[model samples]
Target: MTTADSSVDKGSVSAVVGDKLSGRVALVTGGTRGIGAAICGSLAAQGAAIAAGFSGNVTKAEGFLADFQGRFGTAVTIHQGNVASADDCRRVVAEVIEQHGRLDILVNNAGITIDKTILKLTDDDWHKVLDVNLSGAFFLSQAALAHMVERGSGRIINVSSVIGEMGNIGQANYAASKSGLFGLTKTFAREAAFLLERAGKLSDDSVGITVNTVTPGYTATEMVAAVPEKVLDKITAQIPLRRLGRPEEIARIVHFLAADASSYITGQVWAVNGGMDM
Candidate 1:
């Protein structure tokens, strides 16, 4: 196990409860900004070494990396690649393992959406969304599982959206991609369970690997910043909380599912939306 030697400075929050994830190595895709950035910060604060993956925006990524290092004194590596490509996914996972020596947490947080009403939606738009959001998660999980299985432990946290559960207008492609994650999570969990059982290690106390999905609802992030004020207002009004979710709030839930305490919570979709779709 990786040792926890970093100290939390005044700028950052304290470790979650018991520093439950201390010493683990985490790979967070799309981690340079917004929700992904928050997830990286939260995990690093809890003493996990972070490998942040970004497809572009080197300036933002550099800033995030510097801030993470300065605030938490955590080890962080920046990887540049498009998650939708299988070869890129494999390379990123390999690089993280090479740098950190092991992979314990894989947060498939990278995603994109191309919104258009079904009649107006082009085939390219549909394929692009599915490629990045659904296929990306699958490819990354496949790459990480090799190392995870070898160690007999790992956490795979896929970021889904509330649209997956409750459909949204102009988001058919996005909805489909996110909905696909639920099935993927359950399928991966069952496969891991079978492997553990075959090894005589399947038990409540020793579930080998945990795979879960975090679905955030109407979060305040760059992904949704382009929505017009009227549209944003409508979305907030529908939410019981009367406000959009902060990225950090979503990150907190992801952090929880990534910790040792969440060992029994595999194959579950933990929604962080504020009563948007209970």
Candidate 2:
């Protein structure tokens, strides 16, 4: 079956990069695979230390940790946490800071999808999706913000989806969860700005704190690969570019936002949707 895809491996470093993110530490949820893995590689290529978060895949996480460190030649480790739990969220942040000495960037990328029509969707379906996709990002961001606010600078980058804006069939819960990030990100950006300002820490030289979201349209990940060929054809046809997005495409934008130069940009959603939406 012909899938709208890219030739690059999600975790491979393909682009030319410099040490722009050097000395910074980034925590990426679900960073062991798919789009998340690509983001890790992108940041690592920019010289950022990585704390890759995975939920339950021990073997995969360990493999990713070893491989990522070898490939990037930077300090890299895997973190295990169920982001739906607030305590776990806090603990993960604390661990990252403790291990890395500080965390400069956070990518709330962990998410799950259980597809079922509304008539067949259970209470667990809706709640679990909301908890993992929406609440998880919130708790993680909240935990990270405490340290960021103390330091007067940090980056919170949320990975949302076009389905959130376009509302896919059998993805009502997923859509709501991803859409919720819009408000969460903007509010956090505002709060971070206000806090830094109140502390008299916002200055021309200050790196400052910022929060933003990246919403990707249909992307060529394992999840998308599982879709039937006909469905993929339909999806590609709707996309103006007629192709699924590459994970690296999404990762590049995230790296851009995580860099020091992006201090002035916040509370915005950067869409890499192949012109799926204007």
Candidate 3:
């Protein structure tokens, strides 16, 4: 049985929470603030160690570490790096493993948007969005997958957007990048299972790796806060819920997928949108 598949009895409750994610190491990019921050807190509450990734904001990074340690009282280590850089992605994974001993969950939550209409979008704008949003997820997943494959157990979760499904004005580049995640996630999901089977890791009672995506609607985050009030109101009116999502709402689903009981779930996209799909 894999680490996640191992059964825990009442006596082991102090060691690892039953049916919840515990004794796992998770690495989350863009994890210091916004939606990523909420994800970290959710996982930490379940007793997982966190390796929070961020760019180069020293002050914010320091505060993030302090706050999480105080709030959840869990083990957390912050890593600074550019997710767009493949070298940085590999290094961060290595560092996390070195610090935490092993990595069990990887959340590709870091993303950037360079919104502009197709006609107005420049090559740099398109590439930058793709590099950070799409390619960053790929590079980081690739590195994480290598370690996961060797160990024969892990979970990779990608964070996408509702805008990827319903395209918006002046966001052609952003939409394309987010949409690309769908294919990326599904392919990762299939390939992970195949590799595990090839390595002779699967059995009637044993489980292997899983990969999935979480598409969140416009949430009450700093990024969504930048939208003009009129524009935000129009967006809200389209939702069946008649309001934006909470970061914790999205975090809850992610926590589910990361837990031991979700072993059968893989290659799926969980959309936490209001009614945007309809």
CA lDDT of every candidate: 0.86, 0.90, 0.86
lDDT of 2 by residue, 1-278 (tens): 00111233535654326799988999999999999999999998897888999999888888787676456656787889999999999999999898889999999999999998888999999999999999999999999998999998999999999998889889989999999999999999999999999989999998899999999999999999999999999999999999999999999999999999998999999999999988
lDDT of 2 at 60: 83
| lDDT tens per residue, model 1, 53-163 | 999788778777766656675678889998889899999999989878899999999999888999999999999999999999999998897788778889999999999
Query: Best by lDDT, which number?
Result: 2
Off by over 4 Å in 2: 1-16
Better of 1 and 2 by lDDT: 2
* Top candidate when judged by TM-score against the true structure: 2
Kindly indicate the candidate among 2 and 3 with the higher TM-score: 2
Give a tens-digit lDDT track for model 3, residues 20-45.
Answer: 67778999999989999999888977
Q: Which order, best to worst by lDDT?
A: 2, 1, 3
User: Cα RMSDs of all predictions?
Assistant: 3.1, 6.0, 5.1
Query: Which residues of candidate 1, in runs, are more than 4 Å off?
Result: 1-18, 200-207
